[model samples]
Target chain A: MAQLTLVQALNEALRHELREDPRTLVFGEDVGRLGGVFRVTDGLQEEFGERRVFDTPLAESAIVGSAIGLALAGWRPVCEIQFDGFSYPALDQVITNLAKYRGRTRGRAALPVTIRIPSGGGIGGPEHHGESPETYYAHTAGLKVVAPSGPAEGYQLLRAAIRDPDPVIFLEPKSRYWTKEEVDAAAAGRLGQARIVREGTHATLIAWGAMTARCLQAAEAAAEDGVELEVVDCRSLVPLDVDTLSASVRKTGRAVVVHEAPLTAGFGAEISARLMETIFRDLKAPVLRVTGYDIPYPAAAVEAAYLPDLDRILTAVQKVLDY
Target chain B: MPSLRPDQLKELYRLMAFTRRVDQEAVALQRQGELTAFPPLTGQEAAQVGSAYALQRQDFAFPSYREMGVAIVRGVDLVEYLRAYRGDWNGGLYDLYAHNFGPIASSVGSHALHAVGWAMGAALDGGGKAAIVYFGEGATSEGDVHEAMNFAGIFRAPVVFFVQNNQWAISVPVARQTAAPIHRKAEAYGFPGLRIDGNDVLAVHAATAEALERARAGGGPTLIEALTYRLGAHSTADDPTRYRQAAEVEPWRAQDPLLRLAAQIDDEDFTRQVVEEVEERVRDLRTRLLSAPRAEPEEMFEFVYAEPPATLAAQREELRQWHS
Candidate 1:
């Protein structure tokens, strides 16, 4: 077991993959010498050589678009989006073409592209630097969306995503970049396998990426009130471990969905709807949700308040239980 | 450089005739409500065919929606070609990797980036092969094209950026696309740029061949701007009469690529035989596509993911239930 931060774990995974597969490449603006803004690709270019890991012009569309082309040309390319909020410039490439090309080719092509985005808020950055745009990728079919809230997940999922035979949007929680955990590089949890952090019969608390740690904290606080809260880390948002989610919700009979993205039309709505359809009759109450506001992510002053903390999560948990 | 051989010129003419016939058939089908829409590449056959002919089977190609000429020259099946026009799927039927040709850029200028990326990959793989990407003057205005050109320039990727300045981007004329010629735009990307007579098939062929050769020889990308005219409506749904006069159209007809190549193949019997053969092939392709069963709406779900997520599968089921 290696004790590493989320960023270090990501760097390790990238280095491992680049060394393991000669076809795997790492490229983005500042990824070569600068080691990425978050240093997730630290030392990759130096070890892998310039051709295997290089830097590109500061163009998001080109970075992602070329990665797709590289994949088509038999190269497994992992492109870093720099930040979550900066990912929109490549939305058309990610959505209109790259996401649909494999299907358009009718399974004749496999675009094994992995796009790395340092996502989520609470780091006290500007609007463009901090945001949760995983919904956009999750909404776009053909692309698998995954987010890792811890160092272990950060390492394993990055490797797994690089090996995936399709395009993957790997959202790393920037807030958790400094969070240290022991990561066993060889032990990889499956892509869509949601991890159950705590076993509780009172209510199930489901969250992912940056919000999973917050959900755990909320669960810890709730334990003082005799409320045994169960926490689940939804590692992969696209495939979505519905079976795990359902089994947890079925046991607890109440659920509180949490995320950093906005409330309306967020991925939470899908989870809520799916829970309703699958475990409606078994539930003690309706699936309650605690999420960010529908407006743009606010400034640093009120960001902590804006993000769902222990109080907010407990509020939703209480509502579900009272119902 | 040596002059064009008789065989090469004849091959170019054969492809040009085939593309022109395909355009005519597509237009006729559109008129008969057989297709959703058709983007006719009438007067610009030389630009697409000649340039595409320059590419080897190993060289990658990225084409805009108006490159039926390129597709035909690349050995794409006619039925599969028309299948896309019928709104069945993305254009053409071939192993995109094996054939080294991408699906037509559904969005105009975005494919330039893809070509640059592919070329960069090709260069990294240590191949003598190069890549070619086609678009129109209107596409040059798009930011993605500029970014792609920038990347290609900086990385020194082996790619040929082929722009067919067909005088208009729908209703917007060439004047609106840019003040200077589109080829000169490549100069900003720190690469060589050339303007060629797009209506002249021989000229288009020579320029593309030279540029591709330079690329394969470790030279960076080249931008070749082929100046031509769209002698028909922008698409089947478009009305050229709404914006332009017949006087503008008449002058381009005089510069038609097919008629210019006529003098090269002056034998009446050869022209007659080739024209008849291409027309017969076009008819057969259209008949096969029309006779084929229409694509099912639910079939769209199949390719949406490598393994369809339960969410999408359930949604597909919901849509089915809602319909019935």
Candidate 2:
């Protein structure tokens, strides 16, 4: 076990995969020499050489479209989309080709490709830099979406994503890149399991990606007020761990879904609806949501107000508790 | 440099004739309501067959939606290939790995990058295999095509970009698609590009063969723009008379690719035998396609992923219960 930041732990995971799997390749814009903008892939190119780790043209569609082809040709490709907002340009390829290739070929072909996107806001970057795009991928049928809240999950989940037989949208929380934790390199974790970050009986705070950290903080604050809030870190979004979520929500009897994406049609709505459908009789209060406003992610100066912070989460938790 | 012998030339003509017959039959089937719609490859037979024929067994071909001739030359089962047009499946029901042919990509120019990427893998594997991708002049204007060509040039991927410039993207003319020649687009990507008489089987075969050889020899990618004409409507549902004049169609009809190849073969007995064979095969195909089994509703839940999530599995069970 070694103490490492999320970015460093992810780099360690990538190094292990590249060294172990000869068919694995890592490539994207600036992923070769610059080691990625966040340096998540730092020292990868030098260690693996340009053949295994390389840079691509600044075209997002080709980056993903070609990855699909490479996967068809019996290669495991782990590509990056730079940032969350820029992922929209490649949405056509992701949805049309990567997500549909297996079904289109009727299981004769499998694209074991992992698309890494440094997702979500809180760093106060420029416009189009800090946006929550996980809902788009989670809603896609053929894709497996996962976002690690901290270092340990980041290390294990990325390794698992790279090894899965299906396409995985690995959303790396950019805001949590610097958070440190001890990650065991040999630890094993499955893709579709949810982790309970905090134990409480009053209510359940369901969140993923960067918002999970905020939920944990809210749980800490609620504990001080003697209102215990259980935080469920939804590591995998597509193959959602509904059993775990239902159990947690049933035990608490109150739930508040949180995300950085806008409230309308966001993934929060899906979770809320799912909870109401299952274990509706077990609930003591109605499920509420704490999410961003239904508008374009505002400029960096006002992004904090747009994103769901600890105060907003606790407010939602209080509302559910009162209900 | 890749000239065809007399026997190979005869074989090429036979494939072209078969493609034309199947295309016509598919159109007739669409008119009779057996198919949802069919894109006729009437005049582009030589362009599709010649280029696809140049590929070796180790090579793969990526085709656009209207390349029934290419699919024929690649040995894809004709009835299975038409399943997409029949609305039986998303692409078609065929063994892609066995035929070395990709699914019919309906989205224009999107699969160009796929060919390049596949070719890059071949290069990485040190296998002397190449990939050929088919598109139309209109597809050249897509952003994916530009990026695909650029990536092929940069990586020197063993790929041949075979553009069947069939003169019409639905109602839009080739002139509206590009001001400069479509072949010249390769020059911007740092590769060689050429134009050919798409109606001439010998020229089409020779150019594609040469490009494939160069790609296999690590000479990088080449772009071939075969200047053909859409002798029929864009699809069974389209009305070409809305935009183009009858006079324009008359000239292209005279320059039909099959007619040009038939004139070159110049053997009445051989042409008759080829036509008889093609008609018999088309009849068999029609019978098989009409009797093909409908897909199961549960198939929608299957093949979405190697392991369906709990939510999808529950939904699938719900659907089964409803049916029960």
Candidate 3:
């Protein structure tokens, strides 16, 4: 076991995958030499040479669409979309082609490509910099959406996404890039399954990417309030852990969903609706949700208010408890 | 390129007729309120069938919604195609093997990237399989198409981009789509590009076959713009008379590839027999299509992912409850 930051874990995974498989290639804006803005891809270009880890002409569409072609050619490409907001320009390729290619081609081709988007807010940045656009890819039928809360899950899931037979939209929480965790080497391939980071029988707080950390923080804070909170790291969002979630919600009879995406039409609504349908009879209260407001992710100064933090999550838990 | 055989010529004529008849059926069904929206490809039959016919069985296709004519030739069940237009399923029920056809892109120019990617895969795997992607001239304006072509060119991926320049994109005309000729744009990307008479099925077949052969031989990508015209309203929901002049449409009607093939064959007896058989097929397909039980609403939740998240399962049940 080794203690590593999320960025370090991600870099380790890329290095391991590239070393293990000759087909793996990494490319994106400033991903080479500069090791990417977040440094998730640091040292890769130096070790692998330009062909394997090269800088692309700042075209998000080309980076993604070309990765699709590269993947089809039997290369496992891990593409960096730089930031959550920068991913929109490539939405055409992500949603329309990358998502649908496997089913459309009837497994004749497998797009074993991983698109890494440094997502979520908290860093003082401009508009479009800190946004949660996973819902768009999650809503899309063909793509698998995954967000790792910390270092270990990030390493495991990034490798899993690269090896999986489908296209994966891997969203990394920008806020936790430097946050450290002890990664068990034994837990690398155990992806696609939700992890019970903290177990409790009172209520389940489910979140992914950046929000999962806040949920954990809220769980710690709620402990002082005499509330036992179960926290789940939703490692994979699209192929979600319904069995784990439903069972947890059934046990607790309450749930609070959290994410950095806007409230309306965000993935939280989908989760809330799902819990209500399956465990409505088991519920002591309606499933409460603490989410980003329904507006374009604002500028950095007010981004804290725009995102669901520990207080908001605690409030949601308290409301569900009172019910 | 393979020399055009008599049988091939005859098949091309028959496919054009079939495409026209199918589009005609869709339009009628829409008029009678049996269908929701019908996007007609009346004048574009030659380009679709001729180019599709030229493809080898192993070659793949990526289609925009208007390429139903090619879908028919590629073995997409006609009724399934209709079901989609009728707002039944996200697409007709055909998996990859049933017809190497892709799902219809309701969004314009989006699937172009899929074609480029697939071609790239074929090249990378040393499969020697080529792919052809079909879209409208309007698609040229889409960034995805541009990206797809650029990628294909740089990688030397074995793909032929077939654009059916049907002269209008919904209400937008071809001239407004781009200042330069659409095919010539391929030159700037470092590939050979051609503009052919789309109404000439022979020309389309010849051009596509050459491109496909070149691609298979590692000659890289080619772009063929079949300059055609749209003879009908964009879809059941459209009214073309508002934007296009009747005079402009009159000339293209005379140049109908369907009519030209029918006339050149001079086999009224063969034409009648084939048309009768096609009509029977369409009638049976319509019965099976309409009577085919509506997909279990739950199935909508089923292939959203190979396995959907708990949230999707929850939403499915929620919808079920709301419906109940």
How high a TM-score does candidate 2 get?
0.99
Clash number for candidate 1: 0
In order, how many clashes per candidate? Answer: 0, 0, 4
Off by over 4 Å in 2: none
lDDT of 3 by residue, A1-323 (tens): 89999999999999999899978889889999999998889899889887678777677887887787667556888999999999989987887778776644434556878999999898887878898898899888778889989898889888888888778999999899889999875665644688888988789999898888899889999888788899888788778777778888899888999988888888888878878877889999998778899888898888888889777888889898888
| Candidate 1: tens digits of C-alpha lDDT, residues B212-279 | 99888889899999999999889998999999999989989999999999887787788888988887
Query: Which ranking of candidates, highest TM-score first?
Result: 2, 1, 3
Strongest candidate by DockQ = 2
Q: Score the docking of each candidate (DockQ).
A: 0.71, 0.84, 0.35
TM-score of each: 0.97, 0.99, 0.83
Name the candidate that leads on TM-score: 2
Error of 1 at B159 (Å): 0.8
- Candidate 2 chain A least-lDDT 10 residues: A314-323
Model 2 interface RMSD, one decimal? 0.7
Q: Tell me model 3's lDDT, rounded to 2 decimals.
A: 0.84
lDDT by residue (B1-324, candidate 2, tens digit) is 846788988999999999989989999999999999998989998999999989999999998899999899888998889988888787788978999899889989999999999998888889599999999999999999999999999999999999999889999999899999988988999999999999888899899999999999999999999989998889999999899999988998988888888888899999999989989999999999999987778778878999888889889999999888
Clashing pairs in 1: none
